[model samples]
Target chain A: MDPAKLLDILGNENRRKIIQLLANRPCYVSEISSRLGVGPKAIISHLGLLEQAGLIECSVDEQRRKYFNIANNMRLEVSVSPYSYTVTLHDVTFDRGKNEEDPVEKEIPPGEESSTLFLKLSSRLKELKKRQEELAQMQQQLQVEYTEAMDHCLDSIEEIARNPVECELLFELLKNETTLATLCYNLRLHPSIVNANLIGLTKRGFIEYGIKNNQYYWKIRETGVENE
Target chain B: MDPAKLLDILGNENRRKIIQLLANRPCYVSEISSRLGVGPKAIISHLGLLEQAGLIECSVDEQRRKYFNIANNMRLEVSVSPYSYTVTLHDVTFDRGKNEEDPVEKEIPPGEESSTLFLKLSSRLKELKKRQEELAQMQQQLQVEYTEAMDHCLDSIEEIARNPVECELLFELLKNETTLATLCYNLRLHPSIVNANLIGLTKRGFIEYGIKNNQYYWKIRETGVENE
Candidate 1:
């Protein structure tokens, strides 16, 4: 799904509340309306949009009453740091056929007591939760390290870059290796100015360029200074 | 920051593009406009909102040119599945005071070669990236386990619950232990109807209630069935 579209769908407070409510259990329009303390008409409209976006679905009961529930397993992750901004959406659907040896699939035995199954499942969930928390902590630590390193890189570039264009050239190169034409286009700078900065950066040992397909592609040197 | 507010800010493609641009390098208003192929007036407005939300900050250079850059280190995570929907915003700031023993902070010696420092930082970042990928895979597996367990729980409740209200009651109980008043409020059902469903569920051994602070709190029984 497009991150912008997903963000737009979730931007409304009522829509977010509806998703939260349905996350716990499926509900019909009236139940959702009353539970959310919103008008039924508004809830219906939100439901329509949610269903269209494939974020939710409806099932009809024997009485012809419709129940709405979450339809997809997905995650949206947005990270904004000094060094990078990224939005990633993952479709996390389970492929049971591919994971035939997964222990979770074989945990429940046929005709087993539902109570014991519940206990086992709940315990497994608790363990997963603990591990997730630990992973989250580790991820946080990594973010800190990333931010610190980027800050240091910026500081070093500030010392080496002689002008604003040179600064921008080095910063862009820090992200990835790219040719001069692409750099000019991305930075909205003239080709001559970008080329001059790239040459200067290479002389200062701040950046280097290699030939690919008969075009020069520039990138930040892993070891920033030369003759150290 | 509020998740809804964050979503609203990121919903605009231009604003998202602006952030993506700044993630590479800070840019002043005119530079941003030219790079994005947007008019200065509209870009300024977008920049204003971003600044107001504290997502971007501007610094004025000696030439009085204002450059905008990312202001915060944060992450927004939204998960949607059959059993849960959650939106969490994390402020991933570096608490240098708290993490005094962190090797990352101590690795860069003052006045050392910037080239060697950059190399070390880059290698450390690569290692962190590898670890993060491993953790992400583990997290995906955990989400699968959670969804499967919740599905199993729902199936068990369907077998035991005799009516819509009973099913709703059990679903609500599956989330956490709550009192009758809270359940009535959350479900938006009549007090008598909620009480009846709770009592029936308790009798059928699907749920159990305990007295706390002179009020009855109900929850799904770990062992769902009454008999072994």
Candidate 2:
């Protein structure tokens, strides 16, 4: 809303470049410019707008030169990609469980908007529910594929299911810090298979993903899933 | 971004008035301005910025123009007052439960500024984990309180523990929806109690509120609490 702030934000190419680069990791202006082959001044000029706009922030490492990072919790959602959710909640005092995540939207406030909110929440929930059902069906197809694939590789379902590296990868995911690439690299599995399993679990409504550091970060959804 | 859009959105006194009204429901312009003593154009003008900036939307209805109210989720987010997260997303697929809204400061996305995609996500996940720990401690506290409260009210732990509405409400919360308010409302409890119990659940780390409307929407944050 501030013209000065808006102009300041757009005035610099460096800041614009910083956003594009920081889309992957939080970095210093020097590292950013060196990586982009630009001058620090260029990056700062644009970063000024972003900072004014409150999109980017700089975390200082004990000095005045700020280490720049994204503002916070701004995961780039696939504009319209379908997502699934499986949730669990526990409270020691309250001995009960609850279902979570809304797919369809609902009406919330004012009057008609409430209807639309309900509609959207319901629609999204139904979409996930449908996907869950599809994944259930696809499990059968996947089972057949698994048999063919497994016959030529691991001798048993338990072997494939409990492969040592897979177990370790699962362990890391349980901690919510590992990514698909890291899992694949560490487990010696193809990225496609790792993604397939993730997507499989996602379809079952057990987990969800958002892009981070230009790759998919994988984590375990259920705390009761043995490792925890 | 566009002055015309801003003027158009707020131009109508009715739309400006609806802006105040939408704090409760997502109202269409007519429904929004319906409560107005002025014309519908008044609401439409003010609605322009709200719509253009992605704070709201316009949709078709069986009859007149329908607008999707989004300000509750984003606009009020920037307010200095407590903007509670109405839902918690437990993307167990990735071993993470995120309630990205901060209780003290809720910042909205600056328009067309650089996005806060990564920072927001990691911070959110980290915060959720921190909350889980905090809630774990709080659950212990609540258990102590509930124990004492029960001593004053009932004799048997089992009898008081089996509060059906609360349990059933918890179940309904887990089955189809992620958030609890609407479900709780549908179950016909006062929104205040629903809000309070949900706060207890959130503190215990069983559920978390994902912010939608200014009202808190909840999601189960763990995997097995419902069946546990």
Whole-model lDDT values for every prediction: 0.77, 0.42
Best by DockQ: 1
Residue-wise lDDT of candidate 2 within A1-228, one digit each (tens)? 332233233334444445655643467888877877988787777666577666667777867667766553221110100111111122223321211121221122343243223223333434443553443333333223322222222221122233454434433453356777777764568988777776655553334566777876665443222211
Cα distance off (Å), candidate 1, residue B68: 3.1
Candidate 1 has a DockQ of 0.46
Instruction: List, for all models, the DockQ compared with the true complex.
Output: 0.46, 0.02
State the DockQ, from 0 to 1, for candidate 2.
0.02
RMSD of candidate 1 to true structure, Å:
4.3
lDDT of 2 by residue, B1-228 (tens): 332233233324444445544533356666656566656785676677567655455666677657655321211101000101111111111111122333322243332211222223323444544553453344344333332332221221122223655444444443344455466545567777767766665554455556766655666453323322
True contacts kept of 1: 0.59
Mark the 10 consecutive residues where model 2 chain A has the least summed lDDT.
Answer: A77-86
State how far residue A187 of model 2 sits from its true place (Å).
Answer: 64
Error of 2 at B51 (Å): 26
Q: lDDT at B124 for candidate 1? A: 58
Number of the top TM-score candidate: 1
Model 1 over residues B28-113: C-alpha lDDT tens digits?
Answer: 89888987899999999999999998889999999998899998788887889877787877877555354456575466565546
